[model samples]
Every structure is written in C-alpha cells, then in structure tokens.
Target: MPPSTVNRQWLLERRPVGAVAAEDFRFNEADIPVPTDGEVLVRSLYFGYDASQRIWLTDDGGYMEPIRIGEPMRTMGIGQVVASRDPGYQVGDLVEGFLSWQDYVLARGDGPMPLRVLPPADHPLSWHLGVFGVGGLTAYFGITDGLQVKPGDTVVVSAATGATGSLAVQIAKALGAKRVIGTAGGEEKCRWVVEKTGCDVAIDYKTDNLDARLRELCPDGVDAYFDNVGGDMLDTMLLHMNPLGRVLICGAMSSGYCDVKMQGPSNYMRICTYQLTVRGILLFFYRDRLAEGAAQLGEWVREGRLHVEEHVVEGFEHAPALLPTMFTGKQPGKLILKVADPD
Candidate 1:
C-alpha cells in the first residue's frame, strides 16, 4: 500500500468555453477509493496527454461519455495494480488503459478499451502509452488498414512531428512507400520531421504554399494521405490526391478540439470526382487487434525501422498546464507526464 492515506486528484472545476486553461481544473485531496466486485485499484505512474481529452470536456464527449464536473479528469495512463477484485488483474501487475488524473484509480477490465495487463518487455513501460500504446497502435492500423499504404506509393502525413504522425511517416517508409511527405508548422519542425522520421520531404504548412509544395513533391499526386490536422489542410489535400487514392481522417488538431462541431472540407466534392477512399480511425474499433498491432510496431522498433520520441513532464501538479500545450506548440512526439514510479 502507498504511504499516504489520501488520494491526490485533479478534478474538473468547469468546462472551458474556448481554449482550455489550467484554471479549469481544481486540485483536491480525498480518501483513497476501494475497489468492489470486478474492479481493480490502480496506483498511477504515467499520464498521456491527448487532444481528445479536450473533446471529453465537451457536453457530448464525442464518442465516449462526457466527463462530469467535480469528477477527476479522464486520461490514458499507466499504473500498477495495488488491489484487485477482478480475476483478470492481480496485485503487482502493471496495466495500461483509461485512468483518471489522480494518485489512485478504480478501473474495470470490460470497457471498450480494456485494462491491458502489460507483459514483460525490454522497452520502457511508458512506451506502452506512446509508440506501443494508442499513438503507435493507431498509426500502425491507420496506415496498414485504413489508408492501405502500398509499396511505391507517395504518402503525405499532416502534423508529422506529432506522436502519431511521426510514427506514421516512418511506418509508411517501412512498408516501402516510394516517397513520404510530412507537414509541420515551422521550418524547425519540418526539418525535424525529415531528419527524425525519414520523411522524403517536409512542408512548412505555416509558411509554405501547401498547394505548390504538394504539386512539386508529389508530381504524380499523393497516393495516400494521413490527415491529422483537418479543416483547410484536408480540403487542400483532397484536391491533390490521385484518383482512387486512400485518405485516413485520423484527427483534427486545427479545430483545437474546443468544440466537436467543426466545418467540413470545402473540396469534399473531389472525393467523388477522384474516387478517393476516405476513412476515419477509432482505436476502439481495433481493440481486439491491439496486441497484433503492437507486435508489428515492436518488431519495427527492434529492426530500427521506427523511431520513438517523447516529451515527458514530471509531477502531477503540471498535468493541467501541459494539456493546453497539446493544441499550442509542443515538442515532437508523444507528450507525457510522469507522476510516480512503480514499486
């Protein structure tokens, strides 16, 4: 058992109107919760920062249930099982799943994304939340299944310096893509995308003329597009796609996730004219194949075909502050907060 009897928590004070701020969450202490039937008590170690957390704060909560006021902020986290009423989880087992912003969390294994019992591995435990977790698994399935990237195909990935995009760039290369193009906000991030993720060309979307760069880089037209920053970027990419090309609508970071009601792309008519295959990816749909995706990602990592980058902040107090940076400029790769070390 932990030395402290109180559970340290960051609870939602109220939903934000536009941009999320640190003031929106209130830090409090309460008695540690006890697990009942089929539930496990978890001691959190790491918390992953995702843009979707902002969507959860909305009235509709996008796909999942909305997080209520006064409740602990929801997050994807790694924790140690301290106590268990469920047969699937045992005390001392490490798990990765939906954990809240608290020192201790009561988790069940039957959710859409189950509380996975992490196996012993040579990689860092936090990697399960990044490359081997949602970000990596999503990129793997999104490229392999959603976009159906093939050898000799020209691929473009928006938000290339991000957690999922960074991996998606390299995964496209690993699968023998003829050329991989990445788009970032600035020259530094664009350069980093090419240097770190092996992107054939990096477009500075903030400064560069996206249409001209796409025309020059992908003369034959983009065969596959991994859309992370939707809105105008999606609209522009649609006009450059080859006929029968594949597009994956993975995220819309440009909207800031402040509201779920976003404007659709103006050039969506191109989808019909080009006969493009546009699809959206939700990790919940591939829950059963998570391990299979992880295995492939692990193999790529070991073979030096994939690169893992993380921007990790320490301490529970910094959680709220780090969240706002997800929409703003954050460093390349997965954004994580280290709360505690497992026993």
Candidate 2:
C-alpha cells in the first residue's frame, strides 16, 4: 500500500479566557511529513481531549511547557506505526504518545511520552488515552499511593463525573473505602458518577448546598478528598474535612479556563485547624513511577474491577468544536476525538 499523503491538524489560534471560545482554534492541512533517520510516521487513531489542556495553554508554572500559539495543539494519541526508520520501532507496530491533533503525525519518538506499542486488542486501544492512560495513572497515584484511603474510610471526589475523578472514585472503592461520595454539577451528572463509579453517595453541587449536603452525606466528615475541580469546591470540601484528613490535589478544572482572575479557596484556614495534609499532584512529576501505577490500573482493568467510560467525538476537523466541550460538562467520561478510524 502507498504511504499516506497528508495530515489535518488543529492549531491554537488564541489563548482562552473564562471559557474557551470557538475562535481560539484553527484547522490546518499539510503534506505528510517524512521522518528523519530515527523517526517514524504515525497515523493517529485516538486522541485525548482533556480539561487539563486548558491549563497547558497558559504559561503557568507547570511540569510541561505551554503549547505555543499558531502551533498544532498538543495531545496524547494512540496510533499505528505505518512507517518507521527508527530501530526502536518498526512498521505495523501500534504505539501511544504525545501526538498532534492530526490525521497523521511525524513522530520523532523524542517527546516525554515517546510512542510505545499498544496493549492487547482485548484491552481496548482507547484506554491508552484515558483509563490505563494518563487519567488512570493520575487517579491511582493520587488516591491509593498519595492519600492512602483505607478500607472503611470516607473518600470524596470533586469533578466526580469527569475522566480522572470517576476513576479515582472507583479506585477508592476498590481499595475498600467504606463510603465514596462524589460531587458533580447537575443531577444527571451526580447520578452518573455514582452509577458508573459505584460511589456510595453522590451530591449535585448545582442543586445542593455544599456544606450542608456534604455534612448530610458524610456525617462523620471527609477522611480523604480527591480534588480535581478546585476553587469553591475545594473550599466547601475543606470545611468538612476530618482531623488528619488527607487531600490529593489533582487538577484545577474549575479554573482551567479562567483567564479572568479568580479567588483561591476561602476556607484554607480549616486545613490548619483540622491538621489536614494537602498534596498537590502533577502526573509528570511522577513519570518515573508511571509504570508501577499503570501496572496496578491494568490489573484492575483486566479483572473487570475497574470500569472506564470514554466519550469519543469523531474527526480531526471536529476537534476545534470538541475541545471546548470539556468545560461545558458535556463530555461524560474521558473525552477523546477519533481523528482517523481509517481502514
């Protein structure tokens, strides 16, 4: 078969404020790139659309560099190695890496997460972009290894319906958390979080009063909190923290798109009063330990102990419109875009 000829990509047009707008992204098409001596040509199959990308656009102090304006947006994708000049990889190998949001990627195999062959077909390739991927690794580290939730302890998760949060809830329960409570935006999302993640209690932050609802659901106070959406959510959750409660700070999704200035948590004093331990986790900072985390998550997936929900959108051309869906709470699970399901 002849090699592919072109690639379509979504480029960053502008930085977003408060919420990402449509004009912030632009689509570009270019000739298929030929690989150098040690590189390969990868045809993208599944690409992740995570809420964390919003934070990546900002030049904030982070583990990774921000995606420059006018450049192809950065993403983690699963692809089949259609062509390779590198000794480490061969043609027809399936791999996952930080590929572009494009139909084809000229992978140099030099990125932080260089292309690695995909797992068994029975394991589901999409998991490389979500659960069993970065999201799952993050959840595993933050909960089991970071917070150390024990059996019969109360565990609460914010952004509970989201990709990482949902997995955290499940992992917490799987580790024997006596009660797992999740907080989400709407009634539907709250229900979905509990139903899918097997959380013991679910609260709708939109409809329920934060302090009161948390008190009602967790009368004994929260023992551990897996925080994904920061801002007011953290403040409320902090107010109900039990003595010696451990909080794993995951992502700041609530403020990821806030170009406008926003207030930090108002109840931070509670952390001192309750003698709480808050740990901020950036997955990249733990890259050396990712394989260990992935192994645990993979075991859970194989045993059917972990359930992953993937909300996939189709086409690279549709990526511009789809990336903003994470902020609107429209994506039910790990948001991904099927750039090319080419046969």
Candidate 3:
C-alpha cells in the first residue's frame, strides 16, 4: 500500500486555565513530512500522555522550553522508522523519543542523540510506557537514589496504584523492602496495588483514616516515602516519618490543576528536628543516569523480578482524553495511544 500524503496532529488552541477543555486542543492535518537529508520519517506506534508533560503545559521554563502557543503539543512516543535519509536508521527500525502528539514524526538525524532502538523484550509493547520505559525508570531511580531504602527498611509510596507508584511498590519489594506500604484513592486501586505488587500494607484514602491507618501499619515509623501525589498526603506522612527518614517528591497531581492556592505542610518543619531529607525529583533532570536505571530495571524485567502495568488506547485521536484521566486519577497504570502505520 502507498503511504498516506497527510499527517494528523493535535495542536494547542490556548493555554489551559485549570483542567483542559476539549476545545483547548484542535486536531489538524498537514502534508506528511518528507525526510530531509540526514533525517528519518517515523510512523508513530504508541504515544505517551503523562502527568509530567501536563505540568510542562501549565507553566513555562521547567527543564525544557514550554510548548509555544499554536504549536503541536509535545509528548514522548515510540515509533518505527518508515523512511530514512540517514545511514543510522533503516526502514522498519523502531525508535523512541520526544515526539509531537501525531501519527507521523520526522526525527532529525542531526537532532539530539536519538534514543537507540532495541529489540522488544519479553514484555508487551505497552511495557515501553509502563514498567520498562520512563515510568519504570522513575520508580527505579526513586528507590535506589532518592530514598535509598535498604533491604530491611520499610518503604511507602503515595499515588500507589498509578503508573510510577505501582512500579515503585514492586521495585521496592524486589529490592527487599521489609514492609511496602501503598496509599491509593479507593478500595479497588488499593486492592490492586496489594494484589499486583504484594505490598505489605495498602491504604485507600477514600475510606481509610490516613493518619490512623499509616501509624498502625508502620508502628516503627516509615523509613522512606516515595511521594507522587503531594498536598495533605505529604503532610500526613511527614508526621509519621522515623528519624533520618528520606522522601522523594516525584509529583504533586493533587495540587497541579487547582485554581486556588495550594496548602503547604506545617509538619514540613519537622524535617530539621527529625533529620529528614526531602528531594523533589524531575525524572528527565536525571537523564544523564538513565543508562544506569535502564540497566537495573531491564535486568529485573527480563528475570521476571518486576511486572508492568499498561493501558493501551488505540488510535492517535485519543491523545487528548488520556491526560484528563490522570488529572482525575482515573486511569490505570501507564496510558499509551496506538497509531496506524504511515503507509
């Protein structure tokens, strides 16, 4: 079959106020981009919609520059090299990297070192978004560096059933966390966290009294906290930290979309008194150490020492709906959008 002449993509209509509305983004089509000299045309297979990118949209100047108004929205996607003008990539070779939210991506060979294509491991394709991809890498680094939880140390993760948190739970257990405590929004998510990750304690914030439950679970006080959702959960956990405890602040989804001012934790002052260490983490900021993380996580997955959670949405048009699910805290695991071949 012949390749299509047009490419479809989602473009920003306006900067979002709070929660993004359907009208905030527009679907547009362009002539399928031709690969210039030293470039490759990639047909996107899967697109990632994560909380980190959403945070980028909300504010300017994080690590990378913000997506300018009226431009194609940015995301991380995996695709196959369909046509190449560069010797490095051949037709049908798979690659993953920062991409526009579109069905076809033109990767500049001269652009920042393109992520090398690798043989798909024993896991499902969606694993690239969940356990084996950036989500997994965050979990891997948080446990190893940010928290430095030892084999017998008790570890707790907030947003416990989401993409990164779910994997963190499993990784902690794999590394021998004596007690793995997970805090999720509801009974269903909490139960899944416990069952899937074999966590020692799972708290459903929707029903459980967080302070009371956490105190009971970690009678010795928590050794490490891998926090994804911040706000009150952080406040509650701070009060329960053991002396010299470590905290990794990975996300603050609870405060991300609010129009009003977010509340700060009064208990945060306890950090000095308890000798607590808190580090706010942006996974991409540690891209220099990505190889170290991928090596450890990949080995674990290959040996069946880790499990991946994935939710695959077919078709590129479904990209906009993916983010709101994360905002509402409704999506299960990592969310990926599947696109058809370019031809």
The C-alpha TM-scores of every prediction are 0.99, 0.92, 0.91
Ranking by TM-score: 1, 2, 3
User: 10 in model 2: Cα distance from truth in Å?
Assistant: 1.7
Higher-ranked by TM-score: 2 or 3 = 2
lDDT of 3 by residue, 1-343 (tens): 2236778888988878777665778989887888989888888778877776765565563456777777788887777888899898889877777778776778865444355564656656656666767788888888888888789999999888888898899889988889999988887887888887778879987889989998788889999999988888899999999999999988877787433345778888889899999987767666678777877888887888776777777867678877677777665588887776433
Ranking the candidates on lDDT from highest down gives: 1, 2, 3
lDDT tens per residue, model 2, 114-167: 677765656667888888788888898899778999998999988888888899
Stretches of candidate 2 above 4 Å error? 1-3, 59-62, 260-262
Worst 10 residues of 1 by lDDT: 1-10
Which candidate leads the pack in TM-score? Answer: 1
Clashing pairs in 3: none
Residue-wise C-alpha lDDT for candidate 1, range 1-343, written one tens digit per residue:
3336989999999999899999999999999999999999999999999999999999999988999999999999999999999999999999999999999999999989999999999988899999998999999999999998899999999999999999999999999999999999898999899899999999998999999988887889999999999999999999999999999999999999988899999999999999999999999999999999999999999998888999888899898999899988999999999999999
Q: Candidate 3: which stretches are off by over 4 Å? A: 1-3, 37-39, 59-61, 85-88, 108-114, 257-263, 341-343
User: What is residue 141's positional error in candidate 3, in angstroms?
Assistant: 0.9
Q: What is the C-alpha RMSD of each candidate to the true structure, in Å?
A: 1.0, 2.4, 2.6
Candidate 3, poorest ten consecutive residues by summed lDDT: 109-118
